[model samples]
Target chain A: MPPLVLHHLSVNYQDLRALRNINLTIHPGQLVGIFGPNGAGKSTLIKAMLGLIPRVTGRVTWGEADLSAHLERIAYLPQRSQIDWHFPATAWDVVMMGRVKPTGWLRPFAASSRRLAQAALERVGMAELAHRPIGALSGGQQQRVFLARALAQEAEIFCFDEPLVGVDQATTGIIFKVFRDLAAAGKMVLVINHDLGESITNFDQLILLNQELIAAGPRQWVLSPEHMRRAYGGEVGFWGHVA
Target chain B: MLPEMGPIHWLLDPLQYDFMLRSLAVAVMVGIICAVVGSYLMVQRLALLGDAISHSVLPGLALAFWLGGNIFLGAFIAGVLSTVLIAWIHRQSSIKEDAAMGIVFSAFFALGITLITVIQKENKIDLNHFLFGNILGVTVADVRDTAIIAALVLGVVVLIYKELLFYSFDPMGARASGLPVGLLNSGLMVLIALTVVASMKVVGVILVLSLLITPGATAYLLVPRLHQVMILGCGIGVFASLSGLYLSYYFNLPSGAAIVLVVSALFSLAFLFSPSQGVISRYRRRP
Candidate 1:
């Protein structure tokens, strides 16, 4: 439950400036949403924080400690398209991957780890399809399986990149329910979402970006019409979650 | 001749010859190592890297021959070097990895071919043995070397199975979880190189690509886990090796080509009849 701080972060992909001069402090118990149009560097920011990508400048610290030093307590769910659905792994196998770090090398998964994985599957409503190969599952089912993987990790800080895209309504509901529960339990939950529909209301805080920080704060203060125009270019509608 | 011989005699008669016995032991060991290392290559979608590394080992083999050093060690060094060059080229330039692999491997392969030709004029070694393999020419030392490599490869795989599994399945996730992906990747490259060097006598450089990729791919159709794929692929590889050896003995065929054909035939069977992912069943599904 430590606060995370980002100081003057920037990323360069060759000549392109993906993220520029970003700074923020994220506290626990917040369900944070990173919203922007395509190419806004939403996914890159998260990757950079976790050191999945090397940042050109700046630093990220989790409660006065380097984020890399505390990676075991973090769980990341990559976007769906980034994964090969045709990979020859069952849903149970994917969830068990969450237990991999804790289970470590030269050893097998403990009984407790297996029980945790089973519980995660049940929590995500995918227990019945646990034995099914990942390729056989629909888009929504795949996302749910990944969510279950994150839950099985028992991580303190959970980050998801586009978890709701192309999923069914049932899946959306279940995911939001779980995110809320995770936040309520004093865990820091960060999500990268491109959707601005009804689901945007679930966030406790919002960080809008379009290659640079637009505005970041409580949802109400961050989603003003002015900020919306700067991030999405012109009016992009605000029917579902805008108050 | 084999038709008249009982299956027991067909199997037992080979044991009388010391050279055949050495070939048999080396063939089995190569089968296991190739399948084990090849499983990782298949799952990572780096099958071409297998081709790249196999071809890249040539320059090393040539250089070792020139320097009066162990060709096997040279091949391993060149194999690892090619991967590093490929990675460096990919990162430093805008070129895609596949393109980088294509450029590096062909250049190294060409260098190897030229060097071998130059050396062959002065030496008595047949270039065919390096290109297509001569399993019948294996010695007791070859058997011992293959055994050691097999043990090392299987031991590392056992020790790091979980990390490799996690890394191959989701590299981004593995990196985020603090696993040293660069080291793991290099370790895998080293293993793949060792497998290629160990397999040179059983199936030469040009054909080792098939041994490295085909068995795992065949098993992938039938199994649903990485380890299962490796275990079943090893079985398929060993079966192909033994059957090919037997076929060569009875029919006066080239052992390497015969083994490759047996493996290809087995791959066709799995492609058409595997329970979960067979073409026959999958094609039968309708909207």
Candidate 2:
């Protein structure tokens, strides 16, 4: 588990600058949260690190290796809206997609891959619905299915974008528990969160950004009054205290 | 003084005519490839892209005809060009993809129709033959061409099935998993163009979208997986093509039009009665 490092990262969506030169290092065994207000580059920060979008500047590396070259060792969950739920695949089929790269091309999935996929579904409490159409599932169930898919990848780095959006309480609890378990097992877990809600307490570390990094460290260290004001104005400190 | 044959004889009698054999060969090949490739389009919500490429191929056909070159190659190039142009326009501007497709395809289609109409006035070639198709008049050369394209399309689909399935279901995830998304996307565009070009001789550009989309959609209503949708769609496409070909033979109707009609009729049946997702099934489950 190499430390994920981003040095001088910047992103531009056409003429609008979405993120400025941002530097950070995420060590193994840490569950980190990227927090920001709307249009504050929280999502852009993750996408830039993963090289998903066109970068205006900088590179990302995992220890000595380039991140792009090591993408297969990472598991990523995009925002829910990025998926087409109406596609004809079932939960079992989708979880099996995680094994595609590992199984390689021009060959069928191994029996072990099937066992892993089924175990992933069982973990997410979606085992019974493995054969149901994805479109028929509730929003929370859909999110759980995707999480199971990422888990089945068995990667050292787990990246999620807005995983908690529109999900029920049970799914959120299960997701956080799994994230903690992965972190305890020495995996690099990075999450993009949109709110200063009750769930903020679950993150072990925090990277506060508003177009740039205002502060990043342990949760208590990054949530100071001064840092909060710099990132999201003074009013946010009140919301933070409430949470 | 009438001649009569058994039902089996009537069905088998068509195989005795060389022209009928050629038409049936083209129909089956077109059906197989269309259903297979069209399943991708249906899942990606790009069914209209099939229509767009089909229409855009007309100019290529007219130009190739004028140049006394291969119409299939010309139409294929034109179809791919249309998709590229659509992607370029959509990416480089504020225009959405749907609007971009509409703008580019209509322009190419108009150019093609104008060129073909003008060429028709001077040559013995009939414009209606290209617009409505002359499946019964397909040469052995056309059958061979269709077979080659069908084999190529089905081969590529089989070779890249799992990767394509992952990409189609969640492209961002596939890319994040280190798949060559750009290459897969380009290959899909090429496959789509080939399917459209091969189909033009059987259903014509104006009606080819139905063959490319209807059967897949019909199967989608009854299935729970992408590959199943494609296989079932192929089966439905073959059945409809056979029945429609026979109906046309008995009633003196246009073979291509009759085939499309049969395909749509099957789709309507699936829409109404598929057990898992159909309107009738849902209504019954509600009570």
Candidate 3:
């Protein structure tokens, strides 16, 4: 059975249909990259998968079990711009929040949770800055911090929206490596991305979406000239090497 | 001319009275609660919400006072109802929260003032005191009510600290995480109402805005976490309360006004000296 299945998912916002009759299945250990233009329902798909939007009409299942049964097994990292980074929380505290529901209220964070937060930060090479306020970090560093926070969740299914935006080349490489490692560990990783060319090489499967699924399959099979034209409203062009 | 034989001699002797002790207790309780909750609101950029809620209680205060019932009960109902109205209007309509807040607070406060003027027909009901409280008139019931309300508010805040932080930092993320963001938002408003009424006697309606915002803003300069900031803010608030009361007695001045002044002074001092986020830290002296 596939790890995640979205069947006939339709989402509406007022008069506009953000997504219509979208159907897809992501198998276990697959690194799926969704490429689309603006207003092409990339982030909307992630939100629907997480049950964020109430107006969604669809059936989502995970590992042959109901999607709602595995709330703790899925981790989602929203776009970096959706947060108020000026909040007076340290990077460690923000990461520690991932352990809160499991630790229960009134109990102080366990030593294991602290170690895990530190380890997650170290994974993103941000362990040394744990004590720093989140507001003090640069945009790329802030993204890394949030990624560490999401990593601390230790979920089997990971979804990241535009994790590569506004980030340096080194951080991008680190993030891709982490995604590859997670996928190799028999976990599913889905990325809503816009870099069409690099996505073709980095992702094991490509899901081209434009308010609907334009194409889906192995990257080499689905990223042909005809599929690119449909997804991009024209030929998908790559001018310069990805930074 | 001896400072030890201070001008507050007469007022200090009043501490021997039970009413005076109750008044002081009520003031301190209100101070701690406001500082604890206010720290989060200030850091989360909701300082104006506190002010809006406080003024929004005016109509309720007038209604309760007119009915010859407990003023807090009225303000509690009025504050919560008005806050919900503002939140709903903001979400369901084109009006922004600021516009909703402006309209709601102004309408409530205006209605309160009008009621007071028309009903009392004079300042005999101590409208000024309610606007700017007089700590000297606190009763035993007032002290008990303040203690209970403060405890309840604090308990709720601590219990939901993680959820509140999550929502404040990123509402979309928190919603996606399946937190009840709407319920938490309403709970915050209710907590604010309880806090405003509890503080009615100490800082009065007029200067209570200072007590709500100052200690938290001061603590924000020194602390990096919400919990620590709240603790520090509470400490600053209590200290300001104690010092303000004592200084007011010694100087023969208003206790509530004195407390706000001291708290503001402390914020000014923090703004000057804090290392990382202080105003002075942002600028360097030319060598």
TM-score, chain A, per candidate?
0.97, 0.97, 0.92
Q: Show how many residue pairs clash in every candidate, following the order shown.
A: 0, 0, 4
In model 1, which runs have C-alpha deviations exceeding 4 angstroms?
Answer: A237-241, B1-3, B283-287
TM-score of each: 0.96, 0.95, 0.91
- Tens-digit lDDT track of model 3 for B1-287: 22655557745775887766886798778889999878767866777788888987888888888888998999888888888888888989889998998888888889888888876774358677678777667888888889899989999988888878877776766655556678878888888889999987778776777888898888889988888888899899998987787676667667778889899999998998788767677676424
Model 3: per-residue Cα lDDT over A1-243, one tens digit each: 356888889988766898988888888787888888888999988888778775467888886676767766667788887777778899987887666555655666788888888899999999999899999987778888887877787777788899988888788888888888888989889898887556448898988888989998897777777777787764456522321
Cα distance off (Å), candidate 1, residue B263: 0.6
Report how far off residue A46 is in candidate 2 (Å). Answer: 1.3
When 1 and 3 are scored with DockQ, the better candidate is 1
Model 1 scores what on Cα lDDT? 0.89
Quality class of the docking in candidate 2, CAPRI style: high
Task: Judging by DockQ against the true structure, name the best candidate.
Answer: 2
TM-score values for chain B across all models:
0.95, 0.96, 0.91
Expressed as tens digits, the lDDT of each residue in B1-287 for candidate 2 is 11398888879877888887788888888888999999999899999999899999999999999999999999999999999999999989999999999999999999998998898888767776677667566898898898899899999899889999999999989999988999999999999999989888767888888888999999999998999999999999888777777777777677778889999999999999999878988899995
Better model by DockQ: candidate 2 vs candidate 3: 2
Error of 1 at B156 (Å): 0.9
Task: Flag clash pairs in model 2.
Answer: none
Model 3 chain A poorest 10 in a row by lDDT: A234-243
